[model samples]
Target: MSEFKMEHKNPEGLFVSKAFSQAITVSGKAKTIYIGGQNATNSKGELIGAGDLELQTKQALNNIATILASENASFANLVKLNIYLLSGCDPRIGYKAFQEVAGLLENPPLVTVLFVSEFARPACLLEIDGIAVIEDKD
Candidate 1:
């Protein structure tokens, strides 16, 4: 199988930042992984953080990590991420936590953030989902 290539770009007229890419193009043989929404829920199905956006965001990111690892992938394989926070919540807290946990990637994935009025779980402060791609070794 041929190697997969991921090209991260920030076009000339667009704003660029270390936090995320404006766009990413993947080519060649690859396996795509779609991660479902994850919150602060732990392995035991118990909420890990309540009323704390930072902790909740970190736990959600960690949950995503576990899912990625199960498929032999990591944060480096991620191409896109969607984060949702409860309305009226401070996003800076969530962003800070994500940086602390996920750290900085050489090629960070494209990210989208939205504010919602509520979540399925009232105690939940945030949720995250992601898409990743990896070379097909087959």
Candidate 2:
């Protein structure tokens, strides 16, 4: 059995959705993973969605998923997500794309979205970083 306990919450007066939780509480002995900001770059370090916010968001999320998989973890173990978007990018576009992927998880993680002027790569439209908690096997 896993030693991790995670709870998602959307308190009164807060909007709710399968794609995200307003708050997340985690307890018990677990291994926490902090993932760096993932961009819309492919394995060859080339940008995937140059000027499309939605497409870039999807690619960034996919990158994060691939990184998590390397550690034997999945979106189900994610507790928090921080999304960064290009200053002029529409957040709704990114949100829609994110929902398409995050909705696959049984419980969504808490999230914060921010708009920034630029990124490490000029063509990057967005980036996503995450924190995940997995049961300690040892």
Candidate 3:
């Protein structure tokens, strides 16, 4: 059995949808994991998507998913996500990819997307970081 309980809510005046929740509350004995910004780099450290925002977003989210899996968690355990996109990239492109990959979760986590002029790697078009809560069933 899981050791944590999650409640996702859209406040009285807020819009509702499977894409995301206005807020997510987590309770119980849980372990929190802070994931650093992930980019479109493969295991060999090669950039997966150079000028494509959608591809980069997908790769970055894939990286985060891998990290979450390492701790026995999945997108369902995510409480928050922070996305960074290159200035010229259309936010819609990245968001569309995100929803396709993350919208399947029973409770999508809160998200904050930002536009930045550049990143550590010039070729990087998008990056994503997140926080997840795992039920410590010990």
Candidate 4:
């Protein structure tokens, strides 16, 4: 089992994800895996469910999943999730997506959601960036 902790907190945090914040202080392997910002697109680079935040959110997550799988990682190995929204995503949407992702695994990773002005792809209603750690299957 891995241990998680909270090393610091932002002074003006309005709604910091307690779970995610605590993960910042976790003690684990010196080695870590980083996932770049994954937009709402498929491996084929096709836009997914354009103009729909929920659909885009799902596709972006799918993209993230693929990335993890490629590295022998799973959502259970996820320590943090950083979400970027292009607007229209209320707290409810965030919560719902969290549930959806959690539902995909036996153990879900902590998450943080931040609203952004825009994404590189205009059709991207949402994006996800995160980190996952897995025991190297040597």
Per-model TM against the reference: 0.96, 0.89, 0.91, 0.72
By summed lDDT, which 10 consecutive residues of candidate 2 come out lowest?
98-107
Query: Which residues of candidate 1, in runs, are more than 4 Å off?
Result: none
What lDDT score goes with residue 36 in model 4?
92
lDDT measured at residue 56 in model 1 versus the true structure, 0 to 100: 91
- Give per-residue CA lDDT, model 4, range 13-101, as digits (tens): 45455344433344544336799998878878899888666677777777887888888766666778888887666656655665686
- Model 2, 3-75: lDDT tens digits are 6788888899999877789888888888889999899898998888788887788888888889888888888
Off by over 4 Å in 2: none
RMSD of 3: 1.6
**What are the runs in model 4 whose C-alpha is more than 4 Å off?**
1-21, 24-30, 104-108
Model 4, position 51, has a per-residue lDDT of: 69
RMSD of 4: 4.8
Among all windows of ten consecutive residues in candidate 3, which has the lowest summed lDDT?
Answer: 97-106
Of 1 and 4, the candidate ahead on lDDT is: 1
Clashing residue pairs, candidate 2?
A: none
lDDT against the true structure, per candidate, is 0.91, 0.85, 0.87, 0.68
